[model samples]
Target: MIAAGLGCRKGTSAETLLSALAAACAEANISRESVSVLATGEIKRHEPGMIELAERLHLPLHILDEAALKQVETRTRTVSKHSLAQTATPSLSEAAALAAAGEASELIVARLIADGATCALARSKDHS
Candidate 1:
């Protein structure tokens, strides 16, 4: 599962938080459906973009209160603070490997994560 939390920053914008989520998902080989993304802070503020991302990627996103998110975020690494698309795309198998030992599931998650980021950026830009 890919997990993301907006660390050390209060009132961080949804775009910024989503960027971190996208980055972690890229590295972990997780997708919207295969993984559950729990975002810290207010979902209402992020509803438009989050919903759009979920629909495009077919992912289920849960926006939790900060305190609750923190409880589960203790051990996970956030890695890149920015989006992962600017980096080179991984091969199908390579991307899958990051997800799990299972070949088929990994590839699906990787592709969805990558595609979800694209949908997010596009949707956000349109709002801007």
Candidate 2:
């Protein structure tokens, strides 16, 4: 399964989130329908843009805690200073994607940034 992990500024619009997702997927040469899930930090569980994005995608939104995010932090290719300071993780999108993609997963796309959001893609080795 493939997962898209996202991070966005507070109060970001759903359109902005969708644009970011599209750009990231385009860079990865994958369609939006290929994404099995959306993932983000638990702190964003109630974020309007996130909620809207998941609803529009018709995919589950997996919320990862700090520990889960940290598990994949070292695997992130991109670094966001603000994300490091705010979330205590170097790359929210990459880390969250890895976390949600399940065990034995690796990042297929590094962090991609748009106007107000960031996205990364990860794919799992265990298809079963």
Clashes of each: 0, 0
User: Runs in model 2 with CA error above 4 Å?
Assistant: none
Model 2: pairs clashing at backbone N, Cα or C within 3 Å: none
User: What C-alpha root-mean-square deviation, in Å, does candidate 1 show against the real structure?
Assistant: 12.9
* Runs off by more than 4 Å, candidate 1: 1-23, 29-33, 36-40, 43-47, 76-128
Query: How close is every model to the real structure, measured as TM-score?
Result: 0.35, 0.96
Could you tell me the lDDT of residue 56 within candidate 2? Answer: 83
- lDDT values for all models: 0.33, 0.90
TM-score of 2: 0.96
Error of 2 at 58 (Å): 1.0
Error of 2 at 117 (Å): 0.2
The 10-residue segment with the lowest total lDDT in model 2: 119-128
